[model samples]
Target: MTRLPKPKALLNKQWLVGLLFVPFMAMALPADRQQPIQIDSDTADIDNKKGVSVYRGDVVMTQGTTRITGDVITIYTRDRELTRVIAQGNKARAYYEELQPGEQGIVQAWGNTIRYDVDSDQIELIKNAQLSQKGDTFTGEKIDYNLTLQTVNAKGTPSQGDNGRVQMVIQPRQEKAASTK
Candidate 1:
């Protein structure tokens, strides 16, 4: 009689409030937050009286676990909230997956331009900005993140003469050795 298996349930905060959460205060999305904002585009343009919405070819967006791809994506809302969201592309990318209480994984970014600011949750990556988590990485031409103060601000643009300079790759933290039964 040996059967022990039941440990798979983490990722919360409503999928980090649709990814990384602007300011990530438990992953934003208030105002009764309803979720559901899937978008796929080959071409799209909506301007409900200038609320603004434009998606160009090869764009992809999700609203729950935060997934973003791009060729172009621009969304800006006002009274309805959602301040801004712009994603351009050559490599604009984004992803999300979070778990606290002991930490989990997944959080990525890449850019040719990727800005997402809901009031001020902030998430701006420009030029060749790159960001990662868990495995640690941070390259830059510009990268600003503050999803709930996880904090990060990188920049590099001396005309990119030497390819600028703002690169990081920290990944050395593994301490778990205390089990004696």
Candidate 2:
């Protein structure tokens, strides 16, 4: 059986799993970028000793302009700081809105599971991971996204057979003509 990481290790890097999954620039917005995160759920179980909390039944989390939703969410914290968040569902989803000057866009992601890492600031999407922004979309078995570097990596689960190939859709960039004086 695969052994789980120590609570400390899990708390530190596990969120990387989720953060790497989302390609939406908003999800990777700088630490100082957004407002405090808020979470809502039908039920929650906190284990102070283990530094873990689990939320079930329609979990929704919001921070600044970013939002993430899932059927179940498990959070790991250390010393009152969030370290990791794992969201799971038939189609766990995440959303982020950009309101920067001269920049306006929306990002959406969905997967069987989503993991967010606070320390390293990464996201990992597992099992049918999909991300979309500005009419662009990416789908694969797994996706890793780096919030800080604004980069994404994807992989397919070949062991599962033919449906496991990576797929992407990128829309052409629109150009404006310059007016001659």
Per TM-score, the best of the predicted structures is 2
Per-residue lDDT of 30 in model 2: 54
Candidate 1 on 1-181: residue-level lDDT in tens? 5534323342233223224332222343332135777899988988878899998888887776566778888989887666888888864344332233224345678878888886787888887888776766777788787766666767677655546756666665579999999
Show model 1 residue runs off by greater than 4 Å: 1-48, 52-102, 105-114, 117-124, 127-135, 142-168
Q: How does candidate 1 fare on TM-score?
A: 0.31
Which ten-residue region of model 2 has the weakest summed lDDT? Answer: 95-104
Candidate 1: the clashing residue pairs are 22-121, 23-121, 23-148
Report the C-alpha lDDT of model 2 over 12-102, residue by residue, as the tens digit. 4434443443333544345433477688999999999899999888888877656778889888988877788888885445432333223
The models' CA-based lDDT, in order, is 0.66, 0.69
**Ten-residue segment with the worst summed lDDT in candidate 1?**
17-26
State TM-scores per candidate: 0.31, 0.73
